[model samples]
Target: MVAAMVKSARKPARRRLSPAEKARIEEIFHRFLSEEDDPRTELNYDSPYTLVVAVALSAQATDVSVNKATARLFEVAHTPQDMLALGEEGLIPYIASIGLYRTKAKNVIAAAKIIMEQHGGEVPLDRAALQALPGVGRKTASVVLNELRIEPAIAVDTHVFRVSHRLKLAFGKTPDQVEAELMAVVPEPYLVRAHHWLILHGRYTCVARRPKCDQCLIADLCPSRGTGARVPAVPEPERHRR
Candidate 1:
């Protein structure tokens, strides 16, 4: 197929994952499991519909801010029908604090209408159908699918992107390339939760400005560990719970 040919033309520039590397990867995840067995998205949503809307609203906003806004928004417009009733103008006031709230309000209303008319008010679980809705991109769909256990996916946000590189789990330049590499190399059992672990790690420990290498449990294995890294400490799990 031409698609296969095109795929092959763009070779995986990163080095192959050898057996030793595979074991190393597993060990890294094992440590993560010891720390936090289950990790969920911080965004508060009761159903698939709310999850989609919440994720779309989360763009250029923190989970805390999204949650703060959605607490009131969801009370009135949690479903496609409810959202349609509220309309774009009605939606803006709820999310005014969030960045790009006006544009997001439009997208949310448009997506809700599409869901109501085309899909009979049910949020599409599949990728293509979800992406067809306004403001619902690949990352949003991936998060929805993975969180619901519909698929094993890694939605590489800024945190995931940085942590992947710092840990040397992936070396790809772009998010898509990094995602492909992570899907290929991350062990199957850990595949689903791997997205959350990396994101949480990057968010709390492997930070951008100056990574808290001293507190990172996987500091010893991280290739990007800064010089003079301290012994890994048992960082309180409660702080990273969100």
Candidate 2:
């Protein structure tokens, strides 16, 4: 009777989803994979060299701007040797409209030189090697790797980070933490495509400032629902793939 009284005195635990609710989350990605015919980077590139330069220039810029710049830029310099020939001055003209074009130009030429001299004009497949390139960071390397399908990696950009937290799929303070949380929870089969799906979703549907929660297919499942709900810690079982 005393034990029963103690149990009664303590507040009941907050409600959480059943296993079926978790399964529903997994199904959401499956639906995304099925819907998106070609889940890949929007940035256009003819070669890995071009992809690297494009991604590097993409910082603080839109894919559209990068594509606009690269269309002419790649035509003239599709390879590292070609890019080096253009030098920073010539590269600037092509990318002048892009944000941070001056710094991007310098890095592009520098990276091109390194690629030509170090990797023999080929973009290194290894993450460390890729990150070693001028202006390349973990996110850029992750994007390159994911696009190549050489590894399953999620590049948590602004959109991805916002969407992940908003959906209560993750509650990380940084991109690395969010990526890890996403990788842990997202099913293995969908790992490769999840990166693109989350990015596109965040870009179009779950946008910043005003998320289209009504249009969001997974809105019902979303804990935050664009209204900043007090999200509970994700359960361990929910963190691992089924």
lDDT of 1: 0.80
Give me the displacement of residue 50 in model 2, in angstroms.
1.2
Clashes of 1: 0
CA lDDT for candidate 2:
0.76
* Candidate 2 TM-score to native: 0.84
Model 1 worst lDDT window (10 residues): 233-242
Q: Which regions of candidate 2 are displaced past 4 Å?
A: 1-21, 226-242
> How far is each candidate from the true structure, as Cα RMSD in Å?
7.1, 11.6
TM-score of each: 0.87, 0.84
Model 1 stretches with alpha carbons more than 4 Å out: 1-15, 228-242
